[model samples]
Target: MESSLATSQMSDEIVCFCGQSSVTRTSLTANNPGQRFRSCSFYGQPDAWDYFSWVDPPPHPRYKAIINKLLRKDNSKRNDEQQLRRLVKCYQIALEVFLLGVIIQKIWL
Candidate 1:
């Protein structure tokens, strides 16, 4: 779980087709959570699209379900947070409008 370890865990054996050295990445996908892979240094670029090699064996089935469930729960929490942010913004605008109306009424009186 150390991000520092992830980048430093290099495979001298793997060099991409583009001649860049491979870097290790942990998969976050539902099907293969926590599994490591070797990817091109030029990943996300046009030429490296096809470069991927597994560095670790496939995860056990039980662990896969647990990780996927955790990921889903985290995603749901983030969605709820975003919805709350929008609601708070709407309330702030409504309060500002109410204050503005009060000021206008006072001036007319």
Candidate 2:
């Protein structure tokens, strides 16, 4: 229950003033991470409709802080996982090189 975003319902039946269908999308900005919103599907196109609405109510200050903290923790874990994978790969290559050297020494002796 870190966030209520998962339980929030997004409106897919929204329509823009210009008669265009609205698309539901989640926000990834620092200030509004994980928040969902609906906007015109044709937004930003030339001569297209522009509209926006939040699916979830504005988060309280406490909720915002909690969400941001969780996001930082998740990102750190991801970075650590990637670094570990790289380290393992380097070790594998070194082991292969060492085994090749040992084989060459045996053949020469």
Candidate 3:
């Protein structure tokens, strides 16, 4: 019974944080593409991340600065605020999903 419970937790079980149904599975490739051992499902797929800003490559020197400046609460610019809020919200959602994956991994594995 204990082992079965563990196995069930290891399987792709989706539980939403907000009392809704979680629809996505946790996969290393979906979470981290830069890792050479993983395959990105959206690799080379057009319109994959339609809303995210295109950072030509990861580890760009200006990327963090851009994100910070855009996220500044004091910034009165409408476009900057909108972009920052959207990105931040998306980040928060992804974080919740990732953390959920970790917890489930621990409980049932």
Candidate 4:
């Protein structure tokens, strides 16, 4: 409930990139779109959301700790992506080496 209120306070009504203030229900039907919800129809696009940079805006001190934790979590995600890529490359290399070894053994034996 608190998060919902935050989102509501953060979001505002504005014309969409298409110059339409409201989109039809058919536009958002697949991604939680329905007659009850209003959307800009460009909700799926990253650029569809308005950007608001906090320029020296003050926040609760507790949020500072939360921000640090979130940054750590973001760094961990990068490490995880890197590890996953390495695993995939290692698997491919191992498979290729195994095939080459099999070919050599068959030819010699």
Expressed as tens digits, the lDDT of each residue in 1-109 for candidate 1 is: 1111122336436665555667789999988998999777766666454567788999999999999999999999999999999999999999999999999999999
Worst 10 residues of 3 by lDDT: 1-10
Q: For candidate 4, lDDT tens digit of each residue in 6-89? A: 122335644444544534343222222222434555544665643222223344457555665666687899999999999999
- Best-to-worst TM-score order: 1, 2, 4, 3
Overall local distance difference test of candidate 2 = 0.74
Candidate 2 error regions (>4 Å): 1-23, 39-52
By summed lDDT, the worst window of 10 consecutive residues in model 1 runs over 1-10
**TM-score: which candidate is best?**
1
lDDT by residue (tens digit), candidate 3, 22-92: 23222223223222221122323463321122223443346555545544534558778799999999999
Candidate 4: segments with Cα more than 4 A from true spot = 1-54
Each candidate structure's TM-score, on Cα atoms with residue i matched to residue i, is 0.72, 0.63, 0.30, 0.43
lDDT by candidate, in order shown = 0.78, 0.74, 0.43, 0.53
Q: Any residue pairs clashing in model 3, and if so which?
A: 6-108
Candidates ranked by lDDT: 1, 2, 4, 3
- What's the lDDT of the predicted structure labeled candidate 3? 0.43
lDDT of 2 by residue, 1-109 (tens): 1111111145536556565567788876668977898766765577665566689977777878888888899999999999999999999999999999999999999
